[model samples]
Target: MVIAIGFEGSANKIGIGIIRDGEVLANVRKTYITPPGSGFLPKETAEHHRNQVLGLIREALDVSKIYPNEIDVVCYTKGPGMAPPLLAVAIVARTIAQLWNKPILGVNHCIGHIEMGRLITGAQNPTVLYVSGGNTQVIAYSNKRYRIFGETIDIAIGNCLDRFARVIKISNDPSPGYNIEQLAKKGKKYYTLPYAVKGMDVSFSGILSEIGRKALPQKATKKRKLDQEDVNELPSHEDLCYSLQETIFAMLVEITERAMAHCGSNEVLIVGGVGCNERLQEMMGIMCEERGAKLFATDERFCIDNGIMIAHAGYEMFRTGTRMKWNDATITQRFRTDEVEINWEVGKV
Candidate 1:
């Protein structure tokens, strides 16, 4: 019977959601789109969030049909995200908390994604493969902590995909990664790229560099003068996209399976921006089927960064008597996945 409002602006998107208990009342969100071949910068992203925050908050409450006084607490993403964007959301959250006279809790962005996935997909104690632009990790719940089993030693999977998308000059209207996934479906040839999986951890920097330098055509003029051998060596943008996805996704699947084996868990839950990819889901599903396990995933609604996840996770923490003072509701750029204590793990199912 607790209603909470959550503010999420840890990246290019700004979202505000209202939730009652485990039910979503409203989830409003908007992404700051950049031109093709460009990524959204922190300063510009923060400005976009600040401009959209108040309107989104009002819309969320209006759509929820819940009054401000009825809301039990306000929650905002505290860290593991872009500082400017995160701080923009935090300032508004703190101001509203003070005005509304409600408690505020700063949520870890990664846990918000995980908790929301469990709530939506109903997967209890599943091995979580969290993939996003800024972070990548295979995690499991142990001893009241979302213990991280493996992670990216360098750049994240989503970052790799996004950078590749930029190299291919894909549109950023919807999302670079989304456009890359679309192009990948049309790929016919599979040019083998460097696969860098070191034990349970993965690395993407080398493969990304390799693709940009040799496997793909750099200039159109150079492409025209290519000999048969050179032409054969260079793959189409489609094939490059496909190879990149397959190689990276395979790396992710391997690590996720390793984590599952280590934990002896039969369920695999995929959550985060990159988790919205249908191909990745299909791949993970195949792996899960081979292992006689279940694959728990969600569509873009729950997979991409959104306000509902923040609100739902806030509710979980709030139910467990979690509280944050106004002064403590600060943002951090490097919050780790295993830092937060999972006190609300009593009845996970």
Candidate 2:
């Protein structure tokens, strides 16, 4: 069996995986935490990646009980991420590949998520809802391409969650998304947040701004401010969280249902970090069941960002002779899934 080492440095996390014949033998992930009171700063993210990537790769190899020389191929995330972080991963993969005298393959980060979902779920031609910190879209396979049928016109759902978490001073926690999800579960959907969708594309910035406006008091006079104690008791934080989730997830479901109708595909698969959202999954499950469509979600291991997806995609590329020169392999923050022609034989489902 040919063993491949996969590297993922798309954003805040550094992940490494070892795969043999498309089977993930080991998956190691390293998360980079920002400083106190800081968000995902590009420079800080890159610097953190430089520190943890090597260790992540080592951990993967160690967990898999495979030496570096045993690997036949090296795969690294190529793009659609922060430039510095992507470059950091590439440098590590390139150096390792050169040292090991193995072929290096670059994989698209978004496609990796979809492909990994496909692998884990054994879904062929499933409509994909790829939601992450950087992206939110409904994708489907047609005419030999993963086409984007629906997406956010402005900020992605994950970004919206991050911003909301920041506003509530919970963005720097161990898992802001998880914290928001927990809070959202606690309260009823009281305030009706805006649900904006144009054609198949949804917009969250307007909804976010609207929620901020509603959350802020109309009057801030000294006398009114003196009633801050009572003011705080008025609006329920959990209610706001619930409403935000309902609006955003309902929009996602609406677009996904529309896409399934347009594409004539009954199967849908959810991928990316935000795909791990329980409420989103439940909503999609209900919609798909009502529409007589199948819905698949990756397990936690496959749901969040990871390196095995890159390795799986790279193996397929390698099998198809999609070799690239050093110059040919460059970072791209706007790479789309439909742009590439994939040969799936190397990646067995």
Candidate 3:
């Protein structure tokens, strides 16, 4: 019977979601899409969140058929995202909490994804592969915390894909990464790219640099301006996209498998924005099938950053007597997944 309202504007997306018990009543979001060849700036993304958050909240509330007073708690992403955007969401969340006189909980963005994935997929004690525009980590619950087994040493996997899409001038309507995924399906050639994996951690900046030098030469990028017809001498964007996905996803799967083996866990849960990628899921499924394990994932509705995740995670904490004081209701840009205190028992499922 716990009803919670969650606000999430950690990056470019502003999401307001209402959840009752473990089910998502409403999940509404709006993304700020920059033009092709440009990345979303934090300031602009924050402004977009500021402008659209109230409307999204109303939409979520209406869709859920719930009133503000009925909400037992209010939750918002506290960190592991861009500072300005996180702050914008935090402000709105605090305001609404005050107006409704409800308890507030600050949830970790990454853990929200993990908890939401578990709730939807019903995977208990699974090894989590969290991949997103801002984060890439292999995690598992240990010692009452989601410990990171592996992570990206440099830029995130999704950031690398997005930047590559910008270099190729892919459409940013649905998502730059989604556009790359579509083009990758048409790719027949497997152009080799750097596959970086140092122990459990991975690196993508080197691969991005190498691809920029080879498939997208500086001279060609400037002269042809990413025009597929004009850049006939270079490798096709499809090939680059395909190769990038193959290499990076292989690195992710390798680390996830290693973590699963180390933790003695057979269930694998993939969460976060990049978890929406079908190819990644297929690859993970293949690995899981070979290992006689199961893979858990969700569609884009729950995979990407959204408030339902925050609300779900927060409701769990709230149910366990975890509440954020008004003074402690703050946001951070570097909140790691392992930093949060898990109040609930881990073996519930």
Which candidate leads in TM-score? 3
lDDT of each: 0.90, 0.82, 0.91
Best by lDDT: 3
Candidate 3, residues 157-186: lDDT per residue as tens digits? 999999988877888889998999999999
Please give the distance, in angstroms, between residue 158's alpha carbon in candidate 1 and its true position after superposition: 0.9
Q: Could you tell me every candidate's TM-score relative to the true structure?
A: 0.95, 0.93, 0.96
lDDT of 1 by residue, 1-349 (tens): 8998999999998999899999999999999999999998999999999889888988998899999999999999998899999998999999999999999999999999999999999998999999999999999998888999999999988899889888878898799999899989999888778888898999999999988875555544643875677677666888888888999999999999999998889999999999999999999999999999999999988888998889888999999898786678899899998999988872353
lDDT of model 1, residue 257: 95
Candidate 1 lDDT trough over 10 residues, lowest sum:
214-223
Clashing pairs in 3: none
User: Each model's number of backbone clashes?
Assistant: 0, 0, 0
Q: Tens digit of lDDT per residue, candidate 2, span 1-349?
A: 6787889988888889888887889998878765444578788888988888777877887789998888888889888888889988898888888888888888988889988888889887877899988899898876656788888888888888888777666655555676788888997757877779899999999998988766666665566563667577556667878889888999999989999898788788999988998999999999999999999997668877898999888876776677878665567877777787766632222
